[model samples]
Target: MSAYAIARLRPFAEPGEDVFTYIERFQSTLDPFGGRFLVHGGQLDEVEGSWPGYAVVIVFPDRATAHAWYQSDAYQELVPLRTRTIEGEVIIVDGVAEDYDPAGMAVRMRAASAGAV
Candidate 1:
């Protein structure tokens, strides 16, 4: 199954030219690991609860690949630059299978919970 790394970022202040440089470098780091940006920009609309700033979604072949890309030395080096400019949260989640169904998921969840009891 595929996986995604999603980021919700709120910039503390306007990004300077160095921020652009960091972005360019960060993008280049993704290609080798089969990671690509799905969404990278400011919010277009807010239908429900507030979204303070931008959102980004990066797709990877699978969860392991997503973790590898995130923990790689090259990407880690740029972490400070990103943290300094923006306050954000990032998470990785596995994608559902092509044949997934809501009912099936509910059943699975119930089974798992029962097992935990």
Candidate 2:
């Protein structure tokens, strides 16, 4: 099944200044893992949270791939940079259906939810 790494980060310190150096360094190390940055530091026009902050999401081929990247030496070294700069939550989730069709699943789920035949 395909998987994703999702993170919600809040600047415990300064968003722009505190994290710039380390993130640039970390980005270079991600090359080996096939890590693609889905979202990085960007302006948030809207936030529905107790804490206003930055959100990031990375997509990997599978759960193992995602875990491997995290446990890799490159990421291990760079993780401290994120830890020191941001207060955040990280999660990895398996995308359902292995090859999911969101529109089709939504139709099925809605039918099931509403008891439609």
Q: Please report the candidate that would top lDDT against the real structure.
A: 1
Query: Lowest lDDT 10-mer window, candidate 2?
Result: 11-20
Q: How many clashes show up in model 1?
A: 0
The TM-scores, one per candidate, come to 0.88, 0.70
Q: Write the per-residue lDDT of candidate 2 for residues 1-117, one digit (tens) a residue.
A: 667888888766564653676777776666776778888768776746464777788877789998988888887887776787678898988767656678997898998989965
- Steric collisions counted per model: 0, 0
The prediction achieving the highest TM-score against the true structure is: 1
Give one digit per residue, the lDDT tens place, for model 1 in 1-117. Answer: 999999988856779766777798988779888999899985559899988888999999999999999999989988888887788999999999999899988999999999999
TM-score attained by model 1: 0.88
Candidate lDDT scores, in order, read 0.89, 0.77
The C-alpha stretches of model 1 lying farther than 4 A from their native spots are 110-117
Badly placed stretches (over 4 Å) of model 2 are 15-18, 45-51, 97-117
